[model samples]
Target chain A: MKGIAKKIQASEVETLRLRLTEAEEALQAIAKGSVDALVVGGPRGPVVSTLAGAQEPYRLVVERMHEGALTLGEDRRILYSNRHFAHLLGYPVAHLVGKPVANFVAPEDAARLADLLDHGAKQPASRELKFRRRDGSATPALVGVGSLTLDQTPALLLIITDLTAQKHSEELAAAERFARSILEQATEAVVVCNADGRITKASFAAERLLDKPLEGKLLADAVPMEVELPAEAHHSGVRMSSREVLELVLERHSLRGAEAQICLPRLHEKHFLLSAGPLSDEPGGCIGCIFTLTEITDRKRAETQQTMLVAELNHRVKNILAIVQSVAWQTLSANHSPSEFKRAFDGRLRALSLAHDILTQGRWGHVDFEQLVERSLAPYHGGDHGMRAQWSGSRLSLPPNMVVPLSMVLHELSTNAAKYGAFSVEHGRVNIAWRSDGVNVLFTWTETNGPPVKGEIKAGFGSKLISRVVSYDLLGTADLDFDREGFRCALTFPVPKLRTDALRPLSAAPSPVH
Target chain B: MKKNAEDLSGYNLRLYIAGQTPKSIAALSNLRGLCEKYLSGRYRLDVVDVMADPALAQRDEIIAIPTLVRCVPEPIKRIIGDLGNSDRVLTRLGIDVSAKV
Candidate 1:
């Protein structure tokens, strides 16, 4: 019992000592400002207490700004910097403070920045400079400078705006403008369209060829282009419609080197060599399309005209060959000797060739009567200066058949006058006149002033040939008379209707004269 | 040790902070981590922003910011600073009696 009583006293002393130690610890904590709360009996109850006012709200604004902020001391050392400023230079905020601002500036721009900050510190200034990152890459920034007194010391405040995204967009816009100017100046017609086939841009050549204000209009409305895609790409390899063609250029992003036809409203159609490609921010990512229309109208017209000319030339050559064969047969059969055949055949072929010259001069269509007379009789008149043979007629266009036969008849008459009639003597004359009587052309040849017909002259091959051609080929009648005054011949034939006949030989489509 | 972890319950703590200052916020953060690692769901923590409750700051004994008070489990304790030094915090409160076991 006595031991148990002693143990109880010992336990009570230990509890008191522990309470004393807790008190001492609490006092130490209070002195160190480590105590969380002091429970005081108030008028109502024990309540929690708090400290004084909080930090300035303006500091939050500075920390949350979009642009970077930096405070530099007189020694150019960074006295303070926000999170944004440190991030702009790829450094931690704690690592950036008290470091020289010039260390982060590019080597080339560092001197210029120092000069501005030193010489122009009084005035607010803004300048562009490159801020180098910790990883050695440089970023463009617009640095705005101002002076402020920070804690009784003069300091410089810098507001830095990163220009990476801004500069990238500006450069892309400038490059697009450059590309547009080049396309506008190019001689080839080019049209740039958006993904939806809107006419965003048109070249000068395209504007002139389309002859319309093309901007903001649908490309299909401005230039109704039709392209012929290959059979594998489309059906039938035929012409695609305007909308389908635009879809082919935009959606398919194809039609490279294809033949395309552009037909604007109320304007003649134009052909172009088409090339299309996509405009994209990256490869395989299409934003829009660019079409290059190289005009091929003149080349197409030339090709068509060449084909038609070949066909026409082939037909004309065969006709000429048939005519020559017949003339050779007649001349060979009629003449009794080689010398006579050579002379007659040569004269007939020369007459036919002279008539062909007039027909060719009229584009292988018809002959002008006056031109035919002048060219055919010039040789008989001693190279046109010593001409005693004179012909007068109204302005008439002869048909193709009349040309060869009449030229032969005129040649025979002139030869006869030169050999045995008016032209055989020095002082001689021949007067040829033709008059059209609504349907028939009455042509009369009168010769005088040289020699008289002395005897009965039998019909030679030249005379018989002239009569037969006037009756057969010309479909006319000839009356010949040999009198003492001179030899006379009167022939009549139908006048030609030259309205539609003049247009038949041009055998391509209704292509323009050009 | 399993019984010690299970015995870590009803440790009520009160924290006093002066708004969002760095030390004030860090103390709360560190205290939370310490509770989560050692006490977890067994502790109740009450935060008092002195800026919001100015009348509470009139208690001069509690004016030091980022002060933490262990109000439960008898013999109330007080701690200071960011509670960043876990060993000091645990030792000062004799909470190592539970942790070091």
Candidate 2:
């Protein structure tokens, strides 16, 4: 009994020492003013005594938190709410408690809250939904729900985070992506550069058009060494260095915007319409400049060609008028009466028009010699008798420059034949033939069965045109033989070598000009 | 009249707050409620907004926000927070500890 009592006494001392240490710790905690709370068994159950420091921090956090916090009962009723939670719903904290949690949820999202609450009971879940406020407005929020115990009863903790700022940033990123896609697919070359003239972005067209990688390179260096500004562009007074030009553009963009045209000679003499504008942030501060280059080479070439064609047409028209004036003067000087002059002038004009028509049909390239001869004699081929003229020649074509003078000579010879030498009477007939001996063509015109010609034909406009103009223009010689039975003419000229490769004779003869 | 003079010369309290933040506003309101029920006209309260006059914070040796300091009535004491627990705050201020609000 003595040993057992000694053992019991030792155990009692150990328990008392433990109690003493606990009392000392409690006293220290109270003296230091760090004791947060004390829980004691009361007659009712248990009562909590909260310290000022502990409760103040929790209240401050609830009042100042950016996110709203709420406690909900198992029945989905609001059991407790912090000041932020009440502020989020535009209600007082006292008013929020005991209210159905669905009152603050949007009507559509309220139905889903039941499922969310059930899921939250098992495990935590997060959802994005809109919440209805006391003021009849809705706000987008990301709500996180987790299970917890409130006053020893099962409850749900809801943390709602506003999504306004996040949504705005996402929309901005989408807009940036859209702008980038447009630049990538654009036909014109586009380059974006920073204030220092360093290229920040280059479009696909810029890579192909500049024929060099543009990104990270200075705008000045992207310009090929061979490219020089045209006189017009220089006169526009953008005569600075390429780097300076970029700087000027960037500076102007900061104020407003600027534009200039640049010529890229290395890219097949391409002309570029360069337009530079500033890239500004939302606050209207310029960050960089965007340079857009559009190739106008084809358009520029067309304009130059049009100018040349107009000048050429003017020169040709003036020469044609001079020729007509000379023809009128010659015809007036030879004829004694206005009627005679009118007849000669009219005939010459007709001849000129016929030559022009043939040239036009050939695209002003060349006229067939055989067709010219036949057309000149077609008017005289008519009559009660069949055609009293016969002709034969090797096929040949003449350039446009030679067609007019040649046509006039042929017309004069035909007129002289009809009036005096051949075809003057009903039984008169004419035979014409030509042959090329490689270097020269020999032509003969023989008149038969007609009244004999006089001793010498007067030096009229027709005869003068036939001899002087034919010889001078064709570089050939012509002689008329006033034979008693008929008048015969012989002509000789150098035949141009046949350009068999570039041109071919028409396969079929032209239709007769009746 | 002697009792009124003694009450007029009672506790001098200064509350340091940072702006009109929710914690500061709650602290000010709760402190007023506590003073009205306990100290009443017997205490002088000086509310200092640090955001408006930041220099006052350094002068008071304030380390935390919403600090209530008892400057007069001898042996100055400080209580930090929104003064939500009236019993603790009243006891720390040498006032009736059993005061309820």
Candidate 3:
């Protein structure tokens, strides 16, 4: 009985020691952990007891953790765990205390985890490790491990903090860097300015435009003629001094105005036109200005050369008029009698004058076929009643080069009508029809109600002139037909010479010769 | 038009005047004793001095001085003159003469 009591007493001491150690560990765990507890029951001896003296372990490493704690030992088995560790793995502590750690890890990560833990156990340091959860999700955690004695056997205490949020922030930061790089390297110039008209940010193209560094400079101070207050604000019922209105409108319209060219001073001896637009975020509020440079020196030079060529063309047309005037005088000098001379001279001069008028109306570019016909028939009509003239079919305007020829052709037709066709009788009529057939212009002049038909014995200078102009000068076909009722003439010319692409040919639509 | 009695109850007036300029000072004291005795408490006077800030003159478009804008009477009337005579001022303003009380 004495030996049995001694053995029981020794077992009681061991139990007491274990109770003391567990009580200390529980106190330390409560202090380190954030879990809420309502009851703190003292270590239960053989009989339940409530003690106020709870000793805290000294020189003990208590790790602050989130998610779970794992105690990995030899043979890869889970030796011990807190309630939180079992909860994290979706298992009860009683069922997990001796379970293999591989049960919770995925097969792929388990091999890696096992190798990492084996390597980790050989080293005496703490590290961050990724763990696989029982739900097949990855848990990135900061794992702290240390050698410890539990029940007189060596083991590991692992405390972890989830790093998922930190990793997400890192990924977001990397994405932001990528976006910033794209914005910085964009091709078009971008400038960001504040409400105060200060250019806070500018792109690489700004250096190309400004030709100098412009960091930390006020926009108005850096760029000339950049005003702060909008031009409208100054014009709103507020009287301003002279030059204020000019300045206001110039600033308002910026680079757009009548002959208001914005010239960016030659960079590397090359000039460019500067176009600008106001950036506005709100109605009636001018935020800032965005200006782009477009090289237009070649275009301007081309336009100037074109205008000069047009002027030279007008001069040549005037010379042609002088030649026609001399021709009229020569034809009159060759006439036999004074009456015939005066009649021929006046007729030729009138025809030349009418052609001149048509050319003038075209600005020396082109003339309408309808206008030329009407002008030629005006004298034969005698006052709108003697000779009736009717026009039908499409409206056609011939270019200046074709105008001189077409006018001469019409003059011949009208002269023949006055001499023998329509205008020879008190009541007669002339009809002119014109239209575009593909790339050719067709015009037919028919005359009726005239004296008995008597063809001319010899063709006059006017007839010869018409033939030369239509057949050679204009590269067209013309025919004169003398029917018993009247005289008819038909002409056709290619349309390319009449089109505007041949240097500003007159508008196709007809304008009356008022 | 029916006229109000020249009693104390009818002629309620408030004049907004600014700083003692020749016009403003003259406009103030010229009608003070004469109008007060005639209009009494029915005429409440309010004077705002504005010579310190010429902006105030611009705000009201006040060009000539000693300008009086009538406030209390409906279709408020205005006149520009030094308050030298009580008779003309009273007649132009259409103040009642029979009941001076």
Which candidate do you rate higher for TM-score, 1 or 3?
A: 1
DockQ of 1: 0.07
Arrange candidates by DockQ, descending: 1, 2, 3
Best by lDDT: 1
The chain B TM-scores of all candidates, as shown, are 0.81, 0.84, 0.70
lDDT comparing candidate 1 with the true structure: 0.73
lDDT of 3 by residue, A265-288 (tens): 544333344344555554857665
| Residue pairs with backbone overlap in model 1 | A49-B56, A49-B57, A50-B56, A50-B57
Give the Cα lDDT of each candidate: 0.73, 0.70, 0.56
What are the per-residue Cα lDDT tens digits for candidate 1 across B13-78? 887766544456556656765766777667887777665655664553553566777777655666
TM-score of the first chain alone, every candidate: 0.71, 0.67, 0.39
- In candidate 3, position A366 carries an lDDT of 59
Q: Show the lowest summed lDDT stretch of 10 residues, model 1 chain A.
A: A505-514
Model 3, B27: alpha-carbon shift in Å? 64
Report the lDDT tens digits of candidate 2 across residue range A281-374.
7998778888777777777777776776676567557656877887788888889899988888999889988987887788666678889988
Q: Which pairs of residues clash in candidate 2, taking residues 3 or more apart in a chain or in different chains?
A: none
What class would a CAPRI assessor give candidate 1's docking? Answer: incorrect
Interface RMSD, in order shown: 8.6, 14.4, 47.8
Mind sharing the TM-score for model 1? 0.63
| lDDT of candidate 1 over A1-514, digit per residue (tens) | 9999999999889768865765675566556645444444468744444322244466567778989988787877776677788888887554555467898999999998997787547899889999999999999999999999864879898999999999999999999899889977899878777778788888888888777777788877777877776544545477876567666655655666778876655544667777777666566666666778787888988888788788876766766677778778878888889998898889878987887777667665666887887777787675644868888999888766567777878888887887888888877888989989998999998989968777788767667777888777767788888778888889887777665744455331111100
